[model samples]
Target: MKNSRGSLVRPHPLPGSASRPVVTPLSPSVVYASDTPDALDDQYEGRVFGYTYSREGHPNGDVVAARLDEMEGASGGIVTGSGMSAVSAVLLGLLKQGDHVLGGNQLYGRSLRMMAEDLPRLGIDTSLADPCDVDAMRAAIRPETKMILVEVVSNPTLRVADIAGIAALAKESGALLVIDNTFTTPRAFRPFDHGADIVIHSVTKLLAGHSDVMLGYAVARDPALNDRLRVFGVTAGLTASPFDCWLAERGMLSFDLRFDRSQETAARLADHLAGLDGVKRVLYPMRADHPDHARAVQLLGDQGCNMVSFELTGGRASANAFTKAADGLSFAPTLGDVGTTLSHPASSSHRALTPDRRAALGISEGFFRVSVGLEDPDALLQIMTDAVAAARAAEG
Candidate 1:
C-alpha cells in the first residue's frame, strides 16, 4: 500500500539473516545486520573525503555505492534518499540556475515535472523532447544545454531511448548525457559503457529488490564529475539511511540473477498480453512495432529489463477495470519489487500532469505499466488474463 508517506514494503524471507542482532532506534550508532565489519576503524576519527556523517557517507552506503559502481563500471558513485534526489542532486551540482536541461518527453511523471515545474523555479531552463529524436536533440542544443537527460527505459510506457545516439549528440554538442537506469538497473544495462556521462538509479525499486527500502544513486564514469556530484550530495543533505543502504547491499548480490529471471518472465507476460484480445498496443522492448525497439536491442542487448507496458482497447474505462481485476497484484504505484506490481499511468504515476499534457506525451488513459517479478509466469499470466476479461465484461 502507498500513501503520500511513501510505499509500505511487503515482507518476504530475507536471505542470510538468522541470528542477526537488532539495533534499537535509541542510539546514535546503529547496526542493521551482522557479518559486516564496523564502518570506521575509529568512529570519531576525522577523515577527509571519507564518511564524516551518515548524511555524507555511511559504511553500508559506501559499500553499496562501491558495489554499484563496479556493477555499472563507473569510476565513482553516490547514493541518495530516493531516485529523484539522485537526479536533483546531480543536476543541481553540475548546473547552476541559468543552465539548461534537455530532458526526455516521455520521462517518469515526477521526472518530467521536475524539469517542467521544479527546475524552472530554481531559475533553470529546460526543454522536453524525444531523446531518441536525434535531429531534434541536435537542434535543441544551446550553449547553455548542460545536460541531456534520458531514461534507459521509460516508466509506464516502456519507451526505450537510444542511449548511444543521445550520448553521441551530447558529446557533439559538448553537453553531458545523463541516463536514468532505474528501469535498466546495472544487472541488465550498463549505461556508462555506452558513452553515458552519468547513470542514475531509483534503487528503491529494483536495486533494493525486496522493496523494503527507499534509495537512489548517481554514478559517474569520470572522477571529476563524480567529485562535484558528491559535494552536492553531501551539502544538499540527500543521503540514504545506513540500514536502508545495508538492505540495498544485500539486494545487490542477486541483481543479475534476479533480473535475468524477471526479464524472461516479463517478455513472456508481454507476449501473452499482446496476443489476447481487448489489447490496443503492447510496449515491451524488442517488439518490432515499438518506436525504438531495434535501437533498444542494439544498446540494451538481450536483457530488455523487467518492465512491460501496453494499452487497453477500450481506453480509460477498460484500463480502470483491468487494474481493478488485478486484485492480487500491488496496484498502488512504485515498481521494482520481488512480486508482480501493476499501475495505470494516466491516473496514478502521471496524475500530476494535466490531462492534455499527459495526452500530449502519449500517456493515454488506456496505458498500463506492469513490472514482472519472481513469480510463476503461468500464474501471473492467468491473473492478468482475468483482468483483461474483467475489462471486456465491463466494456459490455
Candidate 2:
C-alpha cells in the first residue's frame, strides 16, 4: 500500500470502514468477541485492538492524528483536550527539572503565563524575547535552554517570525524549535518546511472553523518526540474525546476553501480599515506597511491568514461603540469562526497581563482583533464602515 511517491498510504476501506456514517460515534471500548484468546492477546500486545481504553487511543482519534501529521509534514502527532493542553504536553513531556526555555514575548497571554508562572514553580526557568528580532532571541538563549517556544504569528498584532532563521539558530544551539502554528493553519504555513522540530495547532480555531470543538494538536518531526508526547497525553489524561476529534476532522475537510475565502476578505478589510477615519493602525501581515511584510512574504508567500487587528483613535470608548453598533458581527473572545467576529484583547485574551505588559506588546485599550470569516467582502466592509462612523460620533 504505497503511493507513487513511495509513501505508505493507508488502505482504502480506510481502517475505520468507508460505508459507515460520516459522523462516528464515541467508541468507549471495542470487544473482539469473534477473536480467540490467543488472537486477542496478540492484538492487545501489538496495539491493534482498536479500543482497549479511550484515553490511550481510539479509531476516531487515530484518523484525525494521521491526517494532521500528514498535513503538518510531521512524523506523528497527538490530539489534546484543548490548545493549552497541547502546549502543556509538549513543554512538560520534553523538558525536565532545571531545564531552561526561551519563549517569545508575543505569545498568546495564557501561553506566556504558563511559561512565566507555571514553569518556574516546577523548577524550570523561562525567558521571553521578541522573536521578530533574531538577535534578541539568540542573546536570550542559554546552554540550559532545551527549547525555544514561539508563535508563528504574534497574537493581536500579527507579527511574523523568521522561522527558518530561528530554526537554524535552535539547531546550532542544540535546542528544539517549537512553533505554535495556531494563527496560520497548515494550509498557509507548514513549519516543518522551515526546519521546525515541532508544530502546535489549536483545532478550536481555524482547523475546526466553527469554533465548536475544543481541541489541540502537537506534531513532531522526530518520531521519538511524538512517542513521548503520546505517552504524556495518556498519563496526564489530556487526550481529546473521540467525538470532538471526529467533529474537528469534519471541520477540517473544508479548511482550504474556508481559509481561502476568509483570507481574501481579510485582505480587502485590512485595506478598507486603513482608509477609515477612526482607525489609527491596521496590522495584517499582507499589508505592505506591516513591519514584517517582507518576512511574511518569505515565509507565507501570498497566503495571509484571516486575522486582522486594528487600533482605534478614540481608545476603549471607540472600541466599545464600534463593537456595540456593528451589525452582522458578533462579539466573541475567540477567532477563526465561520462568521466574522471581534475580540477586545484588553478584556479577553491579553487581560491577564499587567497594563504595562499589554502596552509593551502594543495591545492598547483601543486595539480590536477581527477574525474574518466566509462572508461577502463588500457587505462586511459596509458594516464595519458604519460601525466606525458610529464610534466616531460617540467620541464627539
The whole-model lDDT of each prediction reads: 0.81, 0.89
Candidate with top lDDT is: 2
Candidate 2 runs further than 4 Å off = 1-40, 47-49
| Overall local distance difference test of candidate 1 | 0.81
Q: After superposition, how far is residue 18 of candidate 2 from its true place, in Å?
A: 11
Query: Given candidate 2, what's the lDDT at residue 135?
Result: 94
In candidate 1, what are the lDDT values of residues 188-261, reduced to their tens digit?
Answer: 77787788888998999887889898899998778899889988998888977878887787787787778889
Error of 2 at 193 (Å): 0.9
Q: Which lDDT value does model 2 have at 361?
A: 91
Could you give candidate 2's per-residue lDDT for residues 1-396 as a string of tens digits?
Answer: 656555546323326655877565655453224246677677668855545567877787788888888888775699899999999999999999999999999898889899989999999999999999889999999999999999989998999987877898899999999999999988889988888889998889998989789999998889899989999999999978778888888998999899999999999999999999988999999999999999999999999999999988887788889998899799999999999999999989998889998898999988999999988899999999999888887787
Pick out the ten consecutive residues of candidate 2 with the lowest summed lDDT.
Answer: 26-35
